[model samples]
Target: MSEAFTKSMARNIFFGGSLFFFLVFVGLTIHTTRELPERDHRENINEMVVLGKKVWEDNNCIGCHTLLGEGAYFAPELGNVYTRFGNSKEAIKGFIMSRPVNGIPGRRSMPQFNLTEEELEGIAEFLKWTSEVNTANWPPNIQG
Candidate 1:
């Protein structure tokens, strides 16, 4: 009831706040651990998807495009590219094959990586798999 701000009062407040925040962090961690498995769509991952991921990494696709909102923002978000391309893997592959739209003054274009057919297929499959993941409506629109 004393008006004086004593050391004990400050210490108690610090410890209490730390405990509360620590508990909150623990709870959030547990919730995320439990929810991620259901949202990640890991069951659909296969050899093609794996290969696609390898191609993506090897080519540094993330250096330009953002996948599920994680990567550089120089290019479009490709998290839902499969859906945006009419849910067709072939369309995705065709677009990738026809890259680096040249002759446009000051227009940014995707560089052609000269990906092999198998790599193309794998990348398309991997993108398709990413599109199926439950991102809670990430990218916010069909344009992505």
Candidate 2:
């Protein structure tokens, strides 16, 4: 506590701290880059998956439902929906096709999008592809 404060000591401390953090940043960047290919399933992308994503965006499905815990929570979480629906693409398609256009009385219900058969299949394929991604157990529930 009796030591005098010096500019040289202060400059050294600042440089040391900056260098430590810079190295940590670089290390984390490298680690993330190396891990992305393993975590993201780019191999699963196809024409149907792309079309399905386009349909999802066109309808603004995220405005009501959450996907991978990112969207609004007004509806059920769809991050794990493929698994929740018993891993059946037909089941997903059926649910979308069965939505009531007028909605139920005094209850929240998904609106019918009047999707074509091709669009329905595309959406199902997209959901299936999304389910194959490595989320490390996101949602953490079977019912979501």
Candidate 3:
């Protein structure tokens, strides 16, 4: 009931707040760990998908486009690109293959990567896998 602030009271408040927040952090980490496997659908990963991921990294695709909201904003979000491409791997491949070798005049354009058939297939499979992940309605729209 005393109006004067005391050192013991300040210490208790600081320790109490820290403990509460620490517990909350631990709880959140546990929850994320439990949910990640189900949401990520890791069981779907295959050889092709692995190869595709390697190609993506080698090509620095993230440098231009985003995957799952991570990467540069210069290009489009490719996390759901498989779905956006009408759920057809061929369409995805076609789009990539169709890009002009030289960019458009005074406009942004995706450059042709000259990927082989196998690489194209791998990338398509990887994109398909990403599309199937349970992102909890990420991108908030179909455009992504």
TM-scores of all models? 0.93, 0.88, 0.93
What C-alpha lDDT do the candidate models reach, one value each? 0.95, 0.89, 0.94
What is candidate 3's lDDT per residue for 9-29, written digit by digit as tens? 999999999999999999999
Residue 39 lDDT (model 3)? 96
Top candidate (lDDT): 1
Residues 1-144 of candidate 2 have per-residue lDDT tens digits of: 536768888898999999999999999999999988888788788999999999999999999998888899888888789999999999999999988646457778798999999999999998888888888887678876
TM-score of 3: 0.93
| Cα lDDT tens digits for candidate 1, 1-144 | 566989999999999999999999999999999999999989889999999999999999999999998999899999999999999999999999999899999999999999999999999999999999999998789977
Indicate the residue-level lDDT of 11 in model 1: 100
Candidate 1 global TM-score = 0.93
Give the clashing pairs for model 2: none
Find the 10 residues in a row with the least total lDDT in model 2: 100-109
TM-score of model 2 vs. true structure: 0.88
Error of 2 at 124 (Å): 0.9
lDDT of 2 at 36: 81
CA shift at 111, candidate 2, in angstroms?
Answer: 0.6
